[model samples]
Target chain A: MANFLVWVVWLGAAFACLVSALAVVSFRNPFYSALALIGNLASLAVLFLLLSGEFVAAGQVLVYGGAVMVMFLFVIAYLGDKSEESPWSGGPSWQIVGAVLAGGAILAEVIVVVGLKAGDFLSSPKPVTRDFGSPAALGRLFLTDHLLAFEVTSIVLLVAAVGGVVLGAHARQGEDPTEVHART
Target chain B: MRGPDIQWYVILSAILFSVGALGVMLRRSPLIILLSVEIMLNAANLLLIAFSRLHGREDGQIFAISVMAVAASEVVVGLGMIVAMGRRHVDLDVDKLRTLRG
Candidate 1:
């Protein structure tokens, strides 16, 4: 039964991911692309949870799929209206060919790198069933061992937040108000 | 791992990552490109946690968490910048982005 659940989770996550990817590519509308990205992120979060990585999964859903995606959609709604030109007119033919070739090369390289070694990067950590969100575990690991890295991440987020404000504000200042702004 | 023996999870991740990369290459909208980048990062994160589980390691989970945190910061700033640029140009198309292009 447990095994069945795991497989089910895996299947569902993969399907969601595939759909989201297609949506990302298929949609010409930037808003729809943003929405698809949200779906993709949510599915990936579910994949994380299925693998028993609960904290990361929760963060994936909350921080990324939730907050960041909404931020992106806001941008889309703001900018996409004025240009009525489809962003999906597609790229130059040569560029598409180049992209395909480059993607293939990267895929081949990754296949070489990640090759035949499921055993290398994994070991059975205490399963989520045994303990979920034990603040003590997070605290101990975070404070003593991972504190420096954690501090760096805080700095990064601070930068991102401040940068967002400064940059977003600058754009508002730059818009040529005489022409059409994003139509509602 | 033999090509066939590679767990479905690993294969799926690689596929997703490639799709994300392709999307980045093909999409004209900055927002779409950003989404593609996020897809690539999530693929990496998925692989990280999967490895942690297969090996019974907490370190992998911890690392994954750190990556997630950093990813959040990236989105906040990165999207802000993209949107800023979008607003200014009123054009997020990749072609117009050649301002920096040599």
Candidate 2:
């Protein structure tokens, strides 16, 4: 019964992810697109839970779904959703065709490469230990083998925060009241 | 009863990645392009976790966590640029983003 429930949750989350992803790219309104992305990220968190990645799943919810989605929504709110000149007008005709062809080619290559030994690749080597996805195991790895990488990530985030503030402040200082009024 | 195979997850990731790539190439709005990039990043993260499970290793999940951190920082800077550009009444189309002087 527990296994059946797991399967149901996995399938449902997977479907939700796919649908929301499509909505993200296809939605014309930026606000709607941002909302779709939130859905996508949240469902992805659920999928992570199914994969026994408790740490990653929590991070996905907090970082991507919560923080990142708020950033996106803030942008959408600041810059009101200006409808495109023509809906569904993605780009120049040739650009659209090229994008489609390139995406299709990449998809085909991935399918071909992964299909050969996919069965063996999918099966787990052994039953997962109870502590596999626990915080203790992950924290131990972070402190030991992955310590340098973790510190580097922290530095990167610090730089990004400082840079974002600098850039945003500069932009605000130079803002033209005329343009703001025009938009309003 | 058995769980869903890793192949399903992998294939889903690939499809999502492809869709993201298409959005990046075809979309004019810089914000949408940024959104597409986020999708691609998530797709890659999904693959990492799947492989981690298959190997019964924790390395891939750790890498995924770091990827998420980087992604957050990236979007922060990108959105800042977007806000700056919007202030100038600059075109949101990435093709015209070459000039920072405005």
Candidate 3:
């Protein structure tokens, strides 16, 4: 019964993930797309939980679904509807055809490689420790085996934060900073 | 009691990645493009965690965390550029932004 429950949850989350991902692409409004992305991220977090990645699942919800998506929504609202793109207007018809073909080709290749060629090898899940994906285990790895990468990621985040402030500052070449601020 | 096969997870990840690629190609809006990129990154994270489970290790989870950090930073910068461009009254269409085209 537990196994059956797992299968059902897995199927539901997987379907939700795919559908919302498509919704993210197909939605005409950027705000709707951002909302769809949040759904997609949430479903992915469910999948993460099923995989026993408790900490990762929580992080996915907190970071992607919460923080990053709010930023996207804010930007979309700030830009307003003026920047909206008509689905069929901008590019030539061939771009859509090419994109669909390319996507199909990629999907086919992966299905062939992972589903057919390596099927037997990946058919089973290995046994895991009781704390395999717990926060403590991940923290130890972050501090030990992956310390350099962890430190580097922090530096990268700092740089990106600085860059965002610099680029987002309202002052342009000739515009007075105070005036720009006042205008907004 | 075991869950679904690891192969199924991999296939699902692949499908999501392909859909994301399609979005990036077909959409003209940079915001959607960035969102699609996030989808692709999440697909990769899914695969990493699946493999981590298959191997009974924490390494994949750690890597996924790093990926999240990187993705967060990327969004910060990308959105900043988009806002900057919008403020300048520049065209938001990616195709027409050819000033850097050489």
Candidate 4:
């Protein structure tokens, strides 16, 4: 019974993900694309929950859906939301042909790679532990096995923060601050 | 409800990644390209978590967390660049930003 519910929820989440992802690539207005991607991210979080990745799901929601989406929205709103339809939408035939060929090639490669020996991974020999993807388990790995990488990630985040502020300041230095808002 | 086959997740991840790659290649807006990259990153992270569950190990999930952190930083830096670009009144068509077109 529980498995049935998981299946149903997974189906709904996957459908939502597919629709929103398609919308992300197809929408002419970038604001719409940003909104669609947020929906996609939220659906992915649900899938993570289905996989028992509680910590990962929370992180996805907090980081991607909350922080990242907010930044995208901020940029869109500040930049003045205009419908800038992609040039690729009505370009010469060769452009579409090339893009389609390239995209198709990538899709074929991914399908081939993922399809190989895929069944073997699903049939696990033992049951996963209740705490397998719990915060405690992930934290243990973070501190012990993956300690170096874990700490390095923190350093990277710090550097990125400083870099962002510096970049923003540099941009602010040349332009009249009032003009930025006025244009919007 | 008998738990999904691991292959199903792999297929979904592959599809998402492919779509994201297409988005990045075809989109003109820098912001949209960044969004595409985020989609690609999430696809990879989902695959990692799925494989972790399949293999009964915490390694993949830990790596996913690391990926999340990297993603957060990436968006910060990318958006900073976008904000900078906006200040210059550079038309958001990224193809025009080429200074070394040799």
Candidate 5:
């Protein structure tokens, strides 16, 4: 019974992904495309839950489906009433090639993942950690075991944030703050 | 009824992941392409979770959560750049954006 449900969830998630992919291409509206992708993302979270990675599932819901999708929608909202239907045309051939190559890669990945006999890893409902989902064990490792790398990543994000501000900033002919700042 | 194991979940994740990859390649819109990448990242998270469940390791979920954070950061910066590019040149053809492509 449980296995059947797992299959049902897995198949549902896969179907959602497939449909969303088609929508990404077929949709005339970019907003609709992003919306469809959210469906795909939500299904992934469900898949995570079924796999017993509750933390990951939560992250998927909070981060991907929630925050990221909102960001995309925000971008779209900012573009509201722009009255431009931005026709997307550059190369259909490239899309076809990409589809083929991507399809092949997925097929290969499926073979590898499925061929790895799952019986090797029993499903015992064992805690993922000594204290599953405990904030302490996870917290210590994030700040300690991976401390240096984590700090480095923070620096990288800082740089990226600054770069975003610089790159996205637009000034009028006689009102360039960046230029004034540079002069200073 | 035997529950589907990690392998099934992984395989399913891979299938969804491929769909995302296809979305990335096929879409002309940079926004859609970015969304596709996000989808791919989600698929990877699922894969990590599957492995964790199979191997009896909660650390896998932890790792996936961190990865999702990194992915979030990446999307913000990347979309900011893409949006900037779009603003400068109404056309967001990535192929055209490649001035550095020798």
Candidate 6:
């Protein structure tokens, strides 16, 4: 029964992930695409939980679903309706065909590789310690084994924050911000 | 109880990545392109966590966390550029923004 329950949840989350991913790409409106991305991220968090990644799963929800997505929503809203894209208006027909063909080719190639070469090794789950994915374990690894990466990530975030503010200020100074808002 | 096979997760991630790639290729909107990039990143994150499970290690999760931070920063800067373009009344179409074309 326990095994059956795990399979059920896995199937559901996988299906949700696929559906929301499609919705994210196919939605004509950027706002709807953003909303679909939130769903995709949430379903992915569920998948992370099933993979025994407790800390990663929680971070997925808190960071991607909450903070990052909210920022996307704000930008979409701020941009107003001008952000909407007419379906395949600017690009030529050949570009669309090429894109679909390339996407299908990538999907087929990955499936073949995973199916043939790595199938056996990846078919079973490895045994894990009781505290395998606990926040404490992750924190220890972050501070010790991956200390430089962790610190570097913080510096990158700071630089990005400063860059965003500088660009925003420059944009505002280029024109009357009120004029843009009024036009929108 | 055993869970579903790791291959299943990997295949799912691949599909998600392909869909994201298609989105980036087919869409003209910068916002949608950014959103598709997020999808691609999340797809990669899914694979990382799955492999982390397969190897019984925490290293992949650490990498996934780093990817998340980088993704957030990318989005912030990209959106700022988009806003700047909007203020200039530049058309949001990516194909027309080719001022650097030789």
Top lDDT hit: 3
TM-score of model number 2: 0.90
Looking at model 2, the pairs that clash are: none
Candidate 1 chain A, poorest ten consecutive residues by summed lDDT:
A120-129
DockQ scores of all models, one per candidate? 0.45, 0.55, 0.63, 0.56, 0.46, 0.65
Which tens-of-lDDT digit does each residue in A1-184 have in candidate 3? 8889999999999999999999988888888989999999999999999899999999999999999999999999999975688765668789989999999999999999886756556876777778889999999999999999899999999999999989988755886433443423
Which of the two, 2 or 3, has more DockQ? 3
Candidate 3 chain B has its poorest 10 consecutive residues by lDDT at B93-102
Q: Compared to the true structure, candidate 3 yields what TM-score?
A: 0.93
Ranking by lDDT: 3, 6, 2, 4, 1, 5
Q: lDDT by residue for model 1 over A125-181, one digit each (tens)? A: 334434433345655777878888778878877887888778767534554743543
Sorted by DockQ (best first), the order is: 6, 3, 4, 2, 5, 1
Tens-digit lDDT string for candidate 4 (A122-171)? 55524687787898988888899999999999999999999899888754
Model 1, runs deviating above 4 Å: A82-90, A112-115, A118-129, A132-135, A171-184, B1-6
Interface RMSD in Å per candidate, to 1 decimal?
A: 5.1, 3.4, 3.2, 3.6, 4.6, 2.9
- Considering the two chains of model 3, state its CAPRI-style docking category: medium
Clashing pairs in 6: none
Residue lDDT tens for model 3, B1-102: 266888889999999999999999998889999999999999999999999998887889999999999999999999999998888777788887766544
Error of 4 at A161 (Å): 1.2
Candidate 1 residue-wise lDDT at A8: 73
Best by DockQ: 6
Per-model TM-score versus the true fold:
0.82, 0.90, 0.93, 0.89, 0.77, 0.93
TM-score of chain A of each: 0.77, 0.86, 0.90, 0.82, 0.67, 0.89
* Candidate 6: segments with Cα more than 4 A from true spot: A170-184
Candidates 1 and 2, the one with greater DockQ: 2
Error of 6 at A81 (Å): 0.9
Chain B TM-scores, listed for every candidate in order, come to 0.85, 0.91, 0.95, 0.95, 0.85, 0.95
